[model samples]
Target: MVDELQDSVPLLVFLGVLSASYVDHVALRRHRRQILHLQVLEYYTRPGDLILFNGRAKVSALQRSLTRAEWDHVAIVVPSRDGGHLQLLEVTGDGVTLSPLTSRLLAYSTFHVRYFALRKLRTPLLSRAVVNDLLERFTAEVEGLSYGLSLRRLLHARQTEPALSRDSTFFCSELVAHAYKALGLISSSSEANDFWPGSFSPGDFVDAELGRHGASLSPEIIIDCKLLEVATATKRSPST
Candidate 1:
């Protein structure tokens, strides 16, 4: 049975790639009208915002298939503290790192970005300074840890009760979830490893088959994940 399942793995992955391609097509078509220029996005976006990436690569397709969601990766916006430049705090293969937002978007021509804003939330409890301090401390603590992609741990996630990750390693969504939890935006009981890239998505997009434990945000904080196409060539106009 193990041999048979092993032999079928390739076929399953191939089918996943095909399915993800179709979904990408439909999603891009539906949100084509809502695309925004990269510069315009950078100017308006601030810290504590979330960014989702949808890539056309086979690995990305497999991720989409595994999670049964549109987003394959997630990142949090962070203050650059360098003349007000925009940067993203993300967990890549190189581990937890900061990268210029515009350059990262420009790196992948086939990948499109979706923005999630929290600026609309007006609550006295939502302190930007506190969140920023937490972000700084969190990033400083886990800056160069290895990206966690252990198949064993992933399989363990299938169990009735998924294990909480308190290790140094972090995948993209796990890192974001941890940050959210540290900022008091999510419940302390929320397991970072239980969150996939799709878990942070707006509305009912979370996949039940993945065994994700659904870490919801605080009721006071509203996430505006409007699918805006980030244009590579488009520049911000002179006037606001």
Candidate 2:
């Protein structure tokens, strides 16, 4: 059964993030709500329709809302970061079911933008064959260490060395290409020199299309991954 199911059409899952540093916690929460609402209104309706969320709490709420609206397939997007050992959870009208985590780990691991891109690119290779190949190659590349150890070492090296980082980015892009290829989607990892043109600064504002799968899929949405941090200090009265 598992082998037969593995031959099905590949699911293309793209993960991206809006940085918490660029948007405050309050604003980020609100933005998430608005985005989910828009998605529900735009694409999901009736039973068996899927609405995916990275967070479990959000998934629960979505499940209730969708059930109230008569939707069935309330799929939650839980990227398994801890290798392939841990099972991912999926909730629906029939209650929660456990499945092998296939999505990229970045979905829940961190709020970093680059991690999001890398993870998204890695999702299409979740099949047993591709995953086994990736595991073997990754192991071969970083011999002697446990899988977790090797992954940590790779991540650290990518962070500490500029050349390694660049190579890692290229590797991530290649993975994304492979994912798209598996799913039969056209993909281009074009680099942008400047997110905004002219004298525009950080908060100036602009809209960019991140990527798109096809005519049937909704356009990939990209918004500024910025967050603002504020600090306040209390004043002390002068001594008499």
Candidate 3:
């Protein structure tokens, strides 16, 4: 019996370790899966909403340090008409293009993400159809444009320039700025006359100006798998 107990101790220890490891992996994968599921769901994010990222890059680090912003990059949410999936219109080193929202979120899930924010524009001002129309116009206009490569130009863009139209190349913020500008959301009336991409950073979405009053924008918290909140809400919804 003594010999049998001694042999069983090693087996028990191994099983305990294996069980603990399985639990840990399950919890971690659960979180990753939740984020993925929510990010891919349709109507989880509306069109024209902006998902901002506090990325890890040399330029992003420099911009964050200099501008006192938690985020350095931004992408525009584009909800599909079929209500099946979503896409993002973004300008990265790969240039301006449309990417699936699920893939984009999955790519970032593994990063040591510093911060994320979802800024949803107030309704009525820019309805769903209006936002879609503006995006279509932009897609047509910037067909062959490359990503903005000139830091000097990006850092120095001024809305006060004689020409109000943005340059051919675009940065992430530039694409967002142009979309809102085309919708007349950030016009002189809103005190957002600075539609220049260089003049705005990803953090500027926090307090967007609308006409005479400054709209206090609150973003959806995007860490700790909180993105699943969208999915949870959907599952509990009577509409769904």
Which lDDT tens digits does candidate 2 get at residues 1-240?
644332222311111122223222432443321111121121122111123332335543353353242121212222233443333333222223334432222233234122111011223324544544443343233222111113333222433322222123322222222223333333333221111111011122111121343212221122221211111235679999
Please report, in order, the local distance difference test score of every candidate based on alpha carbons.
0.56, 0.26, 0.53
Worst 10 residues of 3 by lDDT: 17-26
Candidate 3 lDDT score relative to the true structure? 0.53
Error of 3 at 138 (Å): 2.0
Candidate 1's C-alpha runs over 4 A off are 1-27, 30-33, 81-83, 110-124, 153-167, 204-240
TM-score of model number 2 = 0.22
Question: Looking at candidate 3, what is the lDDT of residue 67?
Answer: 53
TM-score of predicted structure 1: 0.65
Query: Global CA lDDT of candidate 2, please?
Result: 0.26
Q: Each candidate's TM vs. the true structure?
A: 0.65, 0.22, 0.62
Please write out the lDDT profile of model 3 over residues 86-180, one tens digit for every residue: 77787877677777776666566556445455555554555567767776776666545677646554464554323333456666776776666
Instruction: List the pairs of residues colliding in candidate 3.
Output: none
* Candidate 2: segments with Cα more than 4 A from true spot: 1-30, 34-170, 187-240
Give candidate 2's total backbone clashes. Answer: 7
